[model samples]
Target chain A: MENQPILSVRNLTKKFGGLTAVNNVDLDIYPGEVVALLGDNGAGKSTLIKCVSGVHSPTSGRVTFQGEDVNFSNPIEARDRGIETIYQDLALANNLDVAGNIFLGREKEKSYLGGLIRSLDDKFMRDRSAEALESLHVEIPSLKAPIETLSGGQRQAVAIARAVYWDAKLMIMDEPTNNLGVPEQKKVLELINALRDRGVPVILISHNLPDVFAVADRLVVMHRGQKVTEKKISDTNSEEVVQYMVGALDDTRKAEVVG
Target chain B: MTDGATKNIKEPGKNASKTILLSLMQVWAWVFLACLVLAFIVAVPLVSGSSVSFLSVRNSQNILVAITPVLLLGLGQTFVIISGGIDLSVGWVMSFASVISALALRGAFNAGLPLPLAVLAGLAMAVVGCGMIGLFNGVIIAKLKVPPFIVTLGTSFIVRGMALLMSENTTVIGLPRGVRNYGNESMMYYVRGDGGGFYFFQKPELTVELLRRMDRIITYPVLMTALVVAVAIYALKRTKFGRYTYAIGGNEVAAVRAGVPVERHIIKLYVLSSVTAGIAGFLSMLRFTAGSAVIGDPLLLSSIAAVIIGGVSLFGGSGTVVGTVIGALIIAVLTTGLVMLNVPSFWQFIVVGAVVILAVLIDQTRDIIKNKIGSS
Candidate 1:
């Protein structure tokens, strides 16, 4: 999994008029490690992910995926290249069922006579969606149940399943455990670990230090639109991480090693 | 992990059962049942107080003529409403199409052209004009970001003004004989033996014309309405465009995020609505054999009201073409029944207004119930 970094961002910078939202940050996410991006609000964490996810193009710098520099015009292009983002909102249509939401834009079709008579392959979709969810350990009662009926944690699970189902190599989750209860958060953490076990690279963005400590293999701290420090989880404690996140860490703090 | 897993398994099953129960009690089910009963009740008067011989085939034929155009217009309105937009210009578009066709037949444009070509010209004019108006509405909503209500309302007045100007505020008459024959034809009949005595009577009895003049009651427009309904149902239920319409109407922001070309799909929906209006216009022209600027005035409100009353959400998404057809039938039956009951025309308007209000109230109640169950 560590043979090559699947996604590499070099000196990526984003500015909104007068403010520097993300200032010359570089990152390399490997194929299997779960990297937790930690920062307080206004710390430019979201801006960095947004740039990588193609919601916002970087103002300057290169985003190279699979060893090739690519510019995504929109999220669709990013998704097509298997860079799936699970936004905090999940973005599932509440009126549609789990399978419907999973295959929202990229719906499967059955066609005959040179695509003249087209029909939805509902049976195939239901079966495949069930297989995907079951493989992910997402215990959904019915694929036909509307998304609005699901709990927050279940919804998050469905979102992750959708991303994974599309064969996304790099999964970016933004504040996934924000409003969830303790058990729900644990479930998400378990799912993240399961993803890493399956050789999927995960980028988890969170304000919760405990969640980060529980799941992340490595930590990347941002302070005022810049990468303050990057460290392996075994080498850093919560206090040292918070210090780096808030821009209070000294040079010695950056040099400290625990591995 | 075990507790969380157990809770998750328990909740979805409960929620699914609740949803199934709620849908069973939906107001649409009741409205659908009510429409069937009303249809039966209305038919009773026509069949009662008269011998089997007293019922005329022409009366049944007249009912079909009155309902066909409205049904077509209702179909167009259903599409627009389901897409979360309204088209008020359909009536005027129909009038414009009919008047232009009638004028064209009178050598307004082509000299000695065949009737079919003239009719096609009328249809094209209606389709292009109404479609443009609809396109304009969609552009304003998509690009300019104006509300659909205001855009369509403004276009309604503009279209009516155009229709009036095109016909010179006068009725265009002298339609071609071929076009006139469509409305004049009757497609159905009832046969009865004509005799004054029983078959075994000792004395011979004089013969009477119990049934006569069987004309085709079902016209081309009526068949067209059926075709339109069938196609609409298929398109809305089976096609990607239909699914996207529901998705966008359900949640526009989510749809856009999902990479749906939101603005383009909406524009197409508007275009489809107006094209249907154009078709309805041509059919109405054929029915009346003359086109007046005032031909589609009542239709503007009636068609929209029909779709709404039939159960298409005024808020958009989650509607069926079948519901719209039922809605059109409801309006037609109500109007015809009122006339049969000798109810004043003014009273009929009052009753329709009441029904529309009731339908909307029922829809709102259903939504509230759904949200309650969903949240729980």
Candidate 2:
């Protein structure tokens, strides 16, 4: 746990005109650990992750990945640097097949006529995509069916497969298990553990408390645009975490002297 | 083990049959076209009592020639519609191209340029000039955030006025005599002259006997259109450009998030649409040996109708160039067949309009069934 942090954020803040969505936040994510980010609605959980994922630029602060400061202007830049964020919507093109979504931004091509013409290498992509899904023990009956036709859990597996195939160093998932059936939620929890075992750190933003308790090594709770408390899994229970989530507990203020 | 078993459950027999049915539905237009041709063949013999053969080579050539321009227009529309946009200015874009090409050709010929060079200049001006107009439409819609419908409609009116003003409201004529020959020349001619001679890749002199005996006509324009169609099919099905077009249409927000350059792609689609329209205009100009401001006016709606009839969704996301080809053929056959039967030409409009609605209804029903199968 004392090894160098893979990602670190210091004094990060984001403001939208008159409102402060995220304020002066400091966080660090170490390698090979699942860190759950728990917060109630409008607690800036999504905004904080969005800033780190390059969806929005922080109003002020610094984000360091692999010990180098990064200011990503778009999601692609962040993804190229080994940061994969699965948004709440999953970011899958509904009309595309599973393999197509897996290779959405970057596609494989076979060139002909000394590079004059390049055609999509769909066979290679499908084979590789199948390998990726198999490694995760995810079963999809058809890789050619459009994403819209897939069940919710299957879509989530495809998104996770994309991150794995790309060898993402850091995974940020927002409410990944939401809207999923109970069995599907268990599958996702298992997948998070698999990612951690492979030494890829994950920052999971979820409202599901039992899921956090089941898979996370540590937890951070945010309340009203501020991180109120962070605790080891053994140090805090769901009741105490809920207290921090609803703004009933404050660790930063407790450290401030009453002078 | 339960997780693996639960997810791996599949009914192979049902899924396999469903996949076959789904693919057949996707290609229903081709089936519809085959049935149409068969019906016309049967009706023509019954009505005319073997006098006018509907399946004759000459009539087939007529239908093929008639569809070239409309097919070109529909090719471009297929791309635009698949990318979730519309280009209403395509007809005027055709007119604009015709005028520009005719003017360039006449100007170059008067300047003592070689005949081939003059023709090349006409083609270059027509294609490049219309491409510029396409670029204008793209920039306004993508950069200024204008709705595609409004932007293209506005450009249609502006281009219409420009074409009328440029041509001074009359047909532009006075091209070289050879220009007319280029339009009518076929690849091979069989002449009954000299005791039945076959002229390969050359137009033999049209004596009364040769005119009466000639049955095979495979023009250069037809070959050129074939090449374009082949290339268009390859591009839409196999290339990154086609995939991106579908992705943008399917869910623009997801495409953008995936780092697809949406605005740049949109601009390219418009440019491609206009270029095809330009080609159609240039071909028609060659076919007529004259350019009229109103040449493409009636064709604008027909082009869109062809695309709709081809199974392309107006809402975007799914379509194929092959489907468009069959759709154009359907309209061409209907128009030519109606004239052969001596029905009023006005009936062509009502029939084509009705076909458009029918095609869309079938497409909608197929989609509903597909959804059901997908979910089940």
Best by DockQ: 2
| Cα distance off (Å), candidate 1, residue B341 | 2.0
Q: Residue-wise lDDT of candidate 1 within B185-302, one digit each (tens)?
A: 4343334344322222121223345334333545677777778889989888777777777777677777777777889988888778777877777778777788777777678788
| Docking quality band of candidate 1, CAPRI definitions | acceptable
lDDT of candidate 1 over A1-259, digit per residue (tens): 3688999999999999999999989999998899999888888999999998888999999999988898998888998898989888888777677877788777788897999888777777788888877777768766787777787888888888888889988999998998988888888888898789888999999989999999999999988888888899999999999888778983334455542
lDDT of 2 at A136: 81
- Candidate 2, A84-148: lDDT as tens digits: 99877888888889888898878899999999999999999999999998888788878997888
Where is model 2 more than 4 Å wrong at Cα?
Answer: B1-8, B12-24, B190-198
Q: What's every prediction's RMSD, in angstroms?
A: 5.3, 2.1
What TM-score does each model's chain B reach against the true chain B? Answer: 0.83, 0.94
Error of 2 at B184 (Å): 2.4
Interface RMSD in angstroms for candidate 2:
2.2
Expressed as tens digits, the lDDT of each residue in B1-376 for candidate 2 is: 2353226356678777667877877887888788878888888877877877787777998899899888998999999999899989899989888888889998999999988898889899988999999999999988898999999999999989998998999999998878876666777776543656677875666767667877547676777788999988999888888889889888888888777889999999999999999988888888899877888878989989999999999999888998899899999999988887778999999999999999998888778877877667
- Candidate 1 at A78: error in angstroms? 0.8
- In candidate 2, which residue pairs get closer than 3 Å at backbone N, Cα or C atoms, i.e. clash? none
Model 1, which residues run further than 4 Å from truth? A250-259, B1-24, B27-64, B104-110, B184-215
Candidate 1 chain B has its poorest 10 consecutive residues by lDDT at B196-205
